[model samples]
Target: MADIPAEGLPPADYAALCDFLRARTGLSFTEAKRYFVDRRIAARMAAVGVATLRDYLNVLRFQASGEELQRLVNLMTVNETYFFREKYQLDCLVRSVLDELARNRRPGSRLRIWSAGCATGEEPYSIAIMLLEQWSRVDEYEIEILASDIDSAVLERAREGIYDERALQGLPAHLRSKYFQPVRGALAADGARWRIIEELRESVDFSLVNIADPRQVQAFRGIDVIFCRNLLIYFDDLGRREAAGMFYDALAPNGFICLGHSESMSRMSSLFVPRRFPDAILYQKPAEGGAS
Candidate 1:
C-alpha cells in the first residue's frame, strides 16, 4: 500500500482505493479516478466521518459488511459506454452469427447473448438493432439478450433505454432518427419525460447481476456469445482465473467470448481458442467432447 498523505489522507487516496477495488471487483482503474471515485465514495466517507482516505481504508480493513462490499465495487466500476460501441463487433454478430442462422434457417432455435457487464444497455441494444436489421426474417426464432450489471442503479437506467444526445456519437442518421427522440434537455428523458421508443425497449432485458457470483446465476448456461468487455482490469490473478473458469463452464460448445482489448485469457489459455472475424477479434470455447 502507498504512504498516507501529510494531510492525513493517503498519498493518492483514489489510487489506494483503486488497488482495493481491483482486489475486490474485476474492474479497472483509469484516468480521472479521483473525480470519479471520490465523487461516488465521499458521501459514505462523510457519513462515517472518516476525514482521511487512510481512515476509510482502516474501516474497510477492520469491519465492512456485505452491502458495504457491494457498494464499494458497484460505485467504483466505470460504466462509460455508448450505443454501437465497438461497431465492428456488432457487424461481426450480424454478418457472421445471424447470417449463418439466416442461411441455415434454424427453426425456433435461439441464439442467446449475454452482455455480461452491460452498463446502461448500450451493448445489448446495439445487439438488438443488429439482430433486427440482419435477421428480421427469423421473426419466429427467439433471439434474446440478457444484459446485466453489478450496479442496480445502472441496470435501472439501462431498462429505461435512453441516452444523452451528447453521448450518442457516430450514430447513423437512420438509427438516430428512428431509435431515439430528443429528451428536452438532458437526453435521457424526452420532452419532460416522454418514454423510450417502445420497440428498442422491447428488444432488451436488463437486470442487476454480479459476474463474481456463480451461485446467483444457475440458469446462465449455453450462452452463444458473452460480451465481458472493459470490465476485467481490476481483478488480480486469482480473480481472473476464477472468472475465466466460470465463463468456461457457462458457455456451450462453439460459444464466443469477447474480452476488452487490454484483457487476456492467456493465463487460462486452455479454456478458449482465439479466432478472428472479418471485423473483430474473439475467442471460442475450446473442444467440448472433442468438437469446438
Candidate 2:
C-alpha cells in the first residue's frame, strides 16, 4: 500500500482511471477512496518508471501485450484468506448443504461447488479436505470443485499448493497429516512448509475469472453450492446488484450461496432468501422463480 500524494494525480486522470477499472473489473472507488486508488496506481506507475497517471493510463489502454492491465488488476484486488476461514459456515456446508444435495442428486451426477474469489486456493482446498473427511466412501460420489480468483499470481501459487504452517493452523492435526506432506525445506517449526497431497490438489480446478463480467460468470451453471466469501464487500451498489443477479443465474434451483460472514444480500437482491442453520447463516436461490 504505497501512499501517493493526492496533489500528484489530476482529476481528469483519476476519473478516466476509475472508468477504465469499473468497465474492466466492476469495482468502484468513492471520493474518499480516490486516495486509495491513487496510491496503488502511483505504486504501479513507479514500478514502470511512468511518473504521471495519464501516461500510465495510456500504457494500460494502448499497450499491445495487455500485461500492464494484468499487473494493475493484481495490485488492486485483495487476496487475504486462510485455510478453514469462517469455519462455522463450512461446517454448515458439510452438515446441511451437502447432505441435501446428495439426497436430491440423480445417480452418477457430479456434485459441483464453486469457490468464487478463492484467494490462493485455501478455501477450495479446505472444502475438498472437508468433503473427504465428511464422506468416508467419498469415491462412491462424484465431485467437481472449481476455484477461481481474479489474481493470476495467487492462482499460480495456489496451483503449487505449498504453504507455511500458519496457513494450516486452523486445520485439525489428523486431517492435516492425511492431506498434506512436508515440503523439502527443513526450516523452523513455525516457518516450516507443507504441500497439499496430490489427491486433494488434483481434485480442484483453478481458473482466472473476473466475477463482474456477466458473460464470464454465467459460465458457472448447475452449481449446487457456491462459496463466495469476502468478495462482494468491494463492489459498489450497481456492481453488487449485477453480481447478485449473476450468482442467481449461475446457481441451480435451491442452490446454496455461502458469503463472507460479514456480507449480506439483504438489500441487494430478493432472488436469494436467507436460510439459518445452527452453525451459520447462508442464502439460497429460490427453487421456483426464474433467475432475476
Candidate 3:
C-alpha cells in the first residue's frame, strides 16, 4: 500500500524500485501494499549483500548472473489460491455449464477444461471432483485438465496432490471422509494433513508455464473452458489486454472463458464475446468467431 515517491526513495528509491516491479512482474501497489513488497523484497537485500533496492536491481542487471532475476519473479508473482475458493463460480458451472454441456453433449463427447494459473492442485482437483460427483461414470467424457503456473516450486507442490484438512472446512462430511486420509504421524502432528484421493489426482496434468511468453501458447491448445480466476488482476491494462487476447485465441469456438470475480472483458474483444450468466459472467467466442 506504500506508494512513496520513487524519486530518491529512502536508502535509494525502493518505492521507485517497486514501480519497476510493476512493469517487470505486473504488481499493482498502494500504501498498504508497500509493506508486503518491502518485507519480501527486503529479504533479497541480505542475499545480494546490497543495502538497497537500487543495489539489488544493479546486481540483477549487471552482477549476479544466476538466481537473481528468476528468484525475484518467483517471489513476486506467487499467488495463494485454494480449492473451491469461489463457490459462486462453481455453483454457476454446476447449474449452467453442466446443463449446457449435457444438452450439447453428442452421442459421445468430452469436456476440456483449463485452469490456467492453477496454484498447486486445488482448482483442477476441485473441478475433477465436481465432475465425478455429477456423473456415476464420469469417465465417459474425455476430460482434460491443464493446470499451469510460472513457479516451478508451486508446480512441483501441485504435482504432489496434497492439502490440509482446513481445505475441507465447507465440504460435506461424507465427501471429506471419503476423499482425505487421516495422517497421524509426526506430520499429522499438525492435525491438518490431507492427501487428495487418487481418482482426483489423476485427472490433472501440471506444467510450468508463463502466460506472457508466446512460446508456451501450445500448452493451451484446444481448450474448451478456462478458469483464469484471480490471476490477471496483477497485470496492468496493456498486459491484461494482451493476456486476454491470448486466452481468446486459445479457446475453441464457443469455448467459455471464466475470469476471476474481479475481472471483465468490457474492452477486450480480440476473440471473446462476454456473456452474462445468472451468477458468474464469462466470455465466449461467438459461433462466427474463426476456428474452434
> Candidate 3: misplaced stretches above 4 Å?
1-24, 28-32, 51-55, 58-66, 98-109, 135-137, 267-271, 290-292
Q: Sort the candidates on TM-score, descending order.
A: 2, 3, 1
Residue 280 Cα positional deviation in candidate 3, in Å, after optimal superposition = 2.5
Model 1: CA > 4 A from native: 1-24, 27-42, 48-67, 100-105, 184-195, 287-292
In candidate 2, stretches whose alpha carbon ends up further than 4 angstroms from where it belongs are: 1-8, 186-190, 290-292
The estimated TM-scores of all candidates read: 0.78, 0.91, 0.82
Q: Which model scores highest in TM-score? A: 2
For candidate 2, write residues 137-160 as lDDT tens digits.
456578899998888999998998
Model 2, 191: alpha-carbon shift in Å?
Answer: 2.9
What is the full ranking by lDDT, best candidate first? 2, 3, 1
Candidate number with greatest lDDT = 2
- Looking at candidate 2, the ten consecutive residues that score lowest on lDDT are 1-10
lDDT of each: 0.71, 0.84, 0.71
Local error of candidate 3 at 142, Å?
0.8
lDDT of 3 by residue, 144-222 (tens): 7888887777787788776776666656777767876666677667676777777677779888777866668666766
lDDT of 1 by residue, 1-292 (tens): 3233433334466668777766555555555445565565676676666766778777776674656656666676678988778788778777775555345546677778889888888788878877776655547677778888888778888888767654467567687777777666565334333335788787777877767677755568988788988766656566677787788888877788888767777654457887787877787886454222
